[model samples]
Target chain A: MQKISPLRSSIEAFNKFKAARLNKADKAQKTNQQSQTNPFGITFKGTVIQMDVFEKAEKVNENTQKAISLKEKMQNTGKLLASAWVGTINKFSSLKTNAIAFGNKIKDSTIAAAKKIRDFGNTKVEFDVFKYNVSRLQNKPVSELRTMLSNELQGVTNE
Target chain B: MNNKRVKNIIEALGKHKDEESIEVLNELGTNCPIDEIREMTSKALIRKNTHRALELMIVNKGKGINDLSARVAMCAINELLALKDKQEAIKILDDTINMHSEKEVQDTARSVKALMSFSS
Candidate 1:
């Protein structure tokens, strides 16, 4: 009994067209589902069959085992490398300590030798030798002095 | 001979007052091929401070201030300048300037005399 507006009529027509298109799309989807092909090229109708279920599970288990083994191998190789590096560092440190100890030993021996020589030089024998040489030089004749001086001069010149 | 032995001998000769010591110094110290020996000899002669020693330094060529080696010559000049009693040195220098046959020796003597007078 009410007057139909132009905008309402157009919206009603659009709704009807949309309902028909949805019904057609639903029918097409059902038809596609009835004859859908799986990724393995096997066609099935209506309900999906659980094909190759045990085989897929076995393949997945195999891949998981391979990954775990690879991870364990990488971890073992890293542990071995770390141990080798630590051993090398220990060896180098030992060598360094040995070198320092050897150097200290050489220094101590050298100092001891020098002290011994100094002690020997401080003895009365050294003084007596020096006195003897001086007295001998004082008593020497002029000709002898000349000859000694000439020899020393010639020696210095040669040097 | 070792350098220490040579040094000991030079020191012994320097302390000796015998005329033969002077002869040795003049012959070996002054005429040596080594400049160090010449320098040591000049110092030894100056230590003697005798008239003959002064004469050797002032009158001789290639010895003392007249030495070819400038280091030896300067050492001799310094020893002369350091003398507590320069009267003998001045007298010898004057004699060298007046009576020395070499003109170079006379000039060296004159220059040394001027330096001595200035230092005094």
Candidate 2:
């Protein structure tokens, strides 16, 4: 069996400690090299992530703009459509009122023409309806005159 | 469940729309990876009585699947639009445009687009 010596044990422990320290130092140096030497890779990666984030933000902004613009257009169009309907109704109402006035004027003219005909019926007027009727129906039946003639003839017969 | 019962349940889930239908459609979109099932999901989305179906169609459009029948449904929906639904309808029309094969469908889409533009 080998006997353990204190000096040897202490020396061994010191060597183990140095090895761990060397390993940690090497790791840190490697990390520093990665950070310092390859600037383009880091910049490329950062640029890519930044651009991706920007693209996503741009899309969100676009969608928001679309929603806002669409809403505005809808509101405006709705108002315009309402105005058009109101205007159409107003136009139709005016047209109807004008038509009614024209109709009343025509009816008044027609009645006046007929009154003139009745008043100047016996006169030689061009538009006298009574004279025109008597002229046209001259050969048609005259029941009242026939009755009068029959009554006179009956009187004669009785006499 | 047997295949027949499972299919009936899935179809029922598709037809009777609710949260359950959304869940089933999602499941069908992901797990049940058959062309026919996918097509059925697309068709069901076309028939769904809500805008969720259109949203699903948009997702499928992003995934590069073409659903032609949905285009016809979109045309049918175009006739019922007020001004408020123009944007959504335009988007649906845009997505549906790529799926059409017949000229009549294209003409219908063009006319609807023209009408929307005129209204605008």
Candidate 3:
């Protein structure tokens, strides 16, 4: 006896539902064609479908693909932000030798990058997670900040 | 992932100081990889104003990710501040104006600060 995985079962169920719905739509189209009749004994008639079914199906499939891509991106939100943060920090440290000469420019660029990171967190992170993160951040020491982000990055990547 | 308990604790924190409870909830919300639970807790924190709800809204106002929630939270924060502790709210907005480089965020802070000033 073989055991099926829950994820596999859920996917199977979704595919079955989708197939059944599509079949019903095809059957309905056929039924509509069969129900068409001519009045006054005029028997010469043909059914003309306006919108292409295949096109509609392709459109639906495209939307589904887009949705799947969005989900994948959402899952990577933590990692993306984490990498950005690390990159910004490294850039700053490497430029420390020229700090006096490029002070204003460095500061401005760093602030801009930081703003982008915050924007990413605020937008991409779910609201509850955002709130929780804000509160959690208040309690943490500055030294431990990277640990938190790294953990988030790991969790997202691991999944 | 006990969402019900998290909700209850957040409600309690709104009324009284529960440092440990808030800390635990914050940890759960931060550490949980599950999207749905984190979302529920985020909403809970916003409604209670336990976290940096207003600050988050101010920073994220222009970005399209969670506009509706941010708008609603901004309104709620405005009302709450308008009723009490207006100075702190004004200071927060002022900091946002001075510190943030994003034009959208600065504009949002300026408008909200003006509205608060007018209302008060």
Top candidate on TM-score is 1
Per-residue error for A90 in candidate 1, Å, reads: 34
Best by DockQ: 1
Cα lDDT for residue A142, model 1?
64
lDDT by residue for model 3 (A6-113), tens: 999999999999999999999978866654542222233554433332255534578888999899998799789999999999999878856766888889999999
DockQ of each candidate, alpha-carbon based: 0.28, 0.00, 0.01
Poorly placed runs, candidate 1 (over 4 Å): A1-140
Candidate with best lDDT: 1
| Candidate 3 structure quality by residue, lDDT tens digits, B36-118 | 43444444444444335445434654221123445444544445444455665567679988998777677767777788788
TM-scores of chain A across candidates: 0.39, 0.38, 0.22
Collision count for each candidate, in order: 0, 0, 1
Indicate whether candidate 1 or candidate 3 has the larger lDDT.
1
TM-scores for candidates 1 onward, in order: 0.51, 0.24, 0.30
Give fnat for candidates 1, 2 and onward, in order.
0.36, 0.00, 0.00
Clashing pairs in 2: none
- Deviation in angstroms for B72 in model 1? 0.5
Report lDDT (Cα) of residue B101, candidate 3. 78
Residue B40 alpha-carbon offset, candidate 1, angstroms: 0.0
Tens-digit lDDT string for candidate 2 (A22-117): 999999887666655443334554532222432444345788899999999999999999999999999999999999999999999999999988
- Model 1 has fnat of 0.36
Q: Which candidate model has the greater TM-score, 2 or 3?
A: 3
